[model samples]
Target: MSANAQMVAKYKNNFLKEVQEQVEMGEWVKMCMQCGVCSGSCPTNFHPGWEHPPQEIFMMIRAGKREEVLTSPSMWMCTSCYNCIVRCPRKLPITHIMHGLANYAHRLGMAPKMQPTRHFAKLFWNNCVKTGRVNELKLSMGLYFKDGFGQGIKNGMAMKDVALGLLKAKRLNPFEMLGGHKCKDQNGIHAMLKKARELEEKRKAIKAAA
Candidate 1:
């Protein structure tokens, strides 16, 4: 076979089980019409090549192109807006599936290239590993000054509105918000992370075998 043909053949051969290993999410496993509603309704669909659209990802998964599906940064690109879920013809919770893919990828270390996201996840781990809850002001401000901080950075000045409201109500103190606080559910978060890590390790071994 020509090199191009050979490459195509290999790609097809490698897609099946790998895609199934992505873990089914919500009703996304069911049949779907190739309508662009999900993409149209998606609030962040306009985002940079961040997501591959639920239809495309689901199609790839169904086609068994596991590596391609798993490696796509689209999963992490989801803003979790749930617009797709509300507009689905079959009522599949597309957003949930997106997260499921992300978790699976993260577990297998096959997650798409997302240095900033991984760094954010590391921050999450660091905070949870320490006090449980994040130090918002620090995390927020730190993220603001950093490039590629995700859309979350856009909320910088917007939060002053909330801060002012909070100050008026005396519900929160600006200084207090700066310091780190232990999570109210620290133990639960710890337990969940521990369990997730263990399961991921087992899955990694299984994947390596295949």
Candidate 2:
């Protein structure tokens, strides 16, 4: 069975339990009282807007709408502004929960494939983790070309002035595309990241066994 399928069977399809055991800070999901303050406090809710706000997501988790909750783009909309956390009467770590849900959904391959936030996050993470330093030029290029080659050219044209300004200011380096400067101890950086992943997996396994 696929990893996701095995997880589903292991959890007996109890999504809330799965989240509690799997996601970071997910054990606090039950503290939500269905108050709409979190939704109201969200700036994205007024502008770009999400399908289901924090409270609604919690409700869905309780109701066991695993697929809907996991596949929705709502969690990816979180900007980590912490407005929800600041305003929540329960003092719940709402921001952490939202990010945790997004991370969990991503791990399960259930997040929206084309979600811009998710795409950008992946690009940024890969760009930084590889060398222990962000290649800003490559990161920008990746984002510009995320749509397509034609769109990428258009995007570049639109930002030509800004690019010129950055180049003149010496803040943006064209040669970094060849190979950016990385941490001195590249091997050590990779080892640390690998160890972190191993520790995380061990922690998750322990949680699951509990």
lDDT of 1 by residue, 133-206 (tens): 66766666656656545645576666779868877999766677665466777788889889987986687567
lDDT of 2 by residue, 1-210 (tens): 999976564333488898898998888998889888999999897545399999999988887888888888999989999999999999889899999899999998989998998999999899988988888888988999988999999999999999999999998887875675687887898999999999979988998999
Instruction: List the candidates' TM-scores in order.
Output: 0.66, 0.86
User: Which residue window of length 10 is worst by lDDT in model 1?
Assistant: 19-28
Error of 1 at 52 (Å): 1.8
lDDT of 1: 0.69
Model 2 lDDT vs. the true structure? 0.88
